[model samples]
Target chain A: MNSELPFLVELIVSAFILTGAGFAVIGALGLARMPDFYMRVHLPTAGTTLGVGCTLIASVIYFSFSLQTLSLHEFLISMFLFITAPVSSHMMAKVALHTGVRYVSHTQGRPWPSRTQRPSRDNSQILTEWPKRP
Target chain B: MLRIAVIIAMLMFTVSVLLNLYRMVRGPDLADRILTLDSLYVNAIAMIILLGIFLGSTLFFEAAMLIAMMGFVGTVAVCKYLLRGNIIE
Candidate 1:
């Protein structure tokens, strides 16, 4: 049998490895350099979703090519990451909001998840006496 | 050899773990520290996977999955605590 197939396969595998490594480095750089918590929260979402996703796919591709069969476990793990990282980031953001971390300096008075809990302009008569609840 | 590649990855992971530790230590706020810890989990999982491939076993993959699951739970728990000052509330 000619050896053309193995070289082509190895080249493809090496390409995947390089792509994964690049994504990982970008995620780390985001972690190191984001200006604040909210932005930082946005940063790792990219890492966990795209970076880890790419890395795991590369793992599966490399192993399957080398072993001449599908190595599917990496695909499963990547799916798990896709499900978990967003939930984690959302939870952290909620925590930050509840802890009064202030996503914006000017909008501190608005209650989260709803603006209906506070009085409308029609009901502003009541808050004028209670010091505005802000 | 794959073993050498795995070793190098492990060394890189060790460095990443330490760098995240530095962020955890000096993070200006709790959220930053938590973020760093979460990144540590991702790195740890990758390192464990590489180690498994190097050693010709699938067992470490089990540990890696467990770590990923547990790390998610831990991060949620910490966020809950920060949000409500209690997990149950």
Candidate 2:
């Protein structure tokens, strides 16, 4: 035990872990409960980004206490996951769009929703960013 | 007191694993299932780290690192497959 550490540290770490568990639970719930594939894609972000971040922090603290050594590796992994998961989600969503799978509900009442979806600058930005390959 | 906290962390990670598994089974889309697997990997890594702490050994840290590495590569491959319909073009 780190005699210098306050009692509240344990409670705080436990809370973070539980909060992560909560986010993961909701992500899974949304995955199952959502009506569409796009919606389902949104679900896992709850776990992948925020939940993993919290748990990694808890792990860092736990290991620091036990080994008295910095476990920066876990923290780095959490950051990597946060960055990659969303990038990949965007890729997956784009592929779903290009593959001609119909979205459950598009603002224009069609799967493609071109007019409403296209006018948005972000939409064009994503399209422009995609690698141009034959 | 530390034991109590460690136990709590272990239980929470276990819960996270179970929840992620639920998504893998029931998600409406393949992408969703893939993401769930990624989450399951991360959560499992965290749990293993906690177990290491609880056991007062650093051995599990290496395992966690390996799992994390595998998860990221696997996600990248799946993302590629989703994009091009073939992982190797």
Per-residue lDDT value at B4 in model 2: 74
After TM-score superposition, the amount by which residue B75's alpha carbon in candidate 1 deviates from its true location, in angstroms, is 0.8
Could you give me the TM-score of model 1 versus the true structure?
0.74
Clash number for candidate 2: 0
- State residue A45's C-alpha deviation in candidate 2, in Å: 2.1
The TM-score obtained for chain B of candidate 2 when compared with the true chain B: 0.91
Poorest lDDT segment (10 consecutive residues) of candidate 1 chain A: A114-123
lDDT by residue (A80-112, candidate 2, tens digit) is: 677777776777666556544445654334445
At residue B80, what lDDT does model 1 achieve?
Answer: 82
True contacts kept of each: 0.22, 0.38
**lDDT (0-100) at residue B40 of candidate 2?**
74
Q: How much of the true contact map at the interface does candidate 1 reproduce, as a fraction?
A: 0.22
Question: Which pairs of residues collide in candidate 2?
Answer: none
Per residue, candidate 2 scores C-alpha lDDT tens digits across B1-89 of 76676677577667657766776776655666666776677677767766765676667767877887788788778878766547878
- CAPRI band of model 2? acceptable
